[model samples]
Target: MTATPAIEGWFTTGDQPALIGERCTTCATSYFPPTAAAAGFCRNPRCEGTEFEQVELSRRGTVWSYTDTRYQPPPPYSAPEPFAPFGLAAVELPEGIVVLGQVAAGYGPDDLRVGMHVELVVEPEHTGEALIWRWKPLAEGSAA
Candidate 1:
């Protein structure tokens, strides 16, 4: 079966992947997990912007905070039997926004720390039939 993005248009896939966001045409504010609309007004309280453009966010970011998911999520989520806990993180990308997502497989809270660099990666969801974005911690001494 072909792997497909569980949530289409939220991100790109390949060697270098990035989250797709919307940039306000007038104020230039960026939003991740982008809006469902093709175009709309900006949300900035001080900016009266009325248009937005699609933009790809930085592939790398710093871990602002993180935690473990102790309980299995409820439906329509299909949790595995004897549910396995996973790490979730709120990463702050270079664009000055915080985006939350799951940590890459084989990694957990023990593998993360505040201010550590991470790269965007795509992985199959529980069913292994769809893809989703996850954060992978950058190795120490390696370029982010």
Candidate 2:
């Protein structure tokens, strides 16, 4: 069976993967997991526009904050067997939003720091029914 996103429409899966967000045509505000239906209205109190466009978000961002998961998460979350700790990061993209995601395998809290540059990557989940976005720390010498 082919893998898919656990929840559809959150991101793109291909040679160049990106988180999909919506940009308000009127006020230029953006939203992730994009607003739909009547919720599609501009979030900005000043703008009344109801039009929004899909946009591919930046693949790189700085680590705004992060943490380690030492224990198995509750139901609906597919935790790895034996439950090794994993890192989670809240990265601030150039678009001015902070998106949270799991850090790439082989990484943990010890390997991360505030403001560290990171890039997006896609990996299969434990169950294999989904492919998920992960964040990888960029090389120290590389500029984001």
Candidate 3:
């Protein structure tokens, strides 16, 4: 079975995966999930820019916080039977925005700490039916 993104238009699946976001043309602020305002404008209150440019957010970031999900999430999320705990992290990127995602396979909340560097990775989800983005902790002394 071919792997496909769990959610489209969020992140790229490639040799180097990155989150897709939008940069306001006027204030130079960026937004994840590429915010689409009904009025079609920048989200910044100080900037009235109506145009935006697509940007790929930093591939690597430092963990701002983390947690272990011990309970199966409610639907539309399809957790596996006999749900297992998984690590999740909020990573702060160079863009000054925080992105949340699951921790990469083989690593758990025990492996995470605030300020730990991590990289974005696209991998098969718990159900193995779709692809999703996860945070892979950087090995010690690995160049950022």
lDDT, candidate 3, at 38: 37
Q: Model 3: clashing residue pairs?
A: none
Predictions: Cα RMSD each: 1.5, 1.5, 1.4
Error of 3 at 91 (Å): 0.3
What lDDT score belongs to each candidate, Candidate 1 first?
Answer: 0.89, 0.86, 0.89
- Give a tens-digit lDDT track for model 3, residues 10-87: 889989998999998889988887874434998788988988888899999999999999898999888878889999
Off by over 4 Å in 2: 36-38
**Over 4 Å off in model 3, which ranges?**
37-39
Residue 80 CA error for candidate 3 (Å)? Answer: 0.9
CA lDDT for candidate 3: 0.89
Residue pairs in collision within model 2: none
TM-score of each: 0.94, 0.92, 0.94
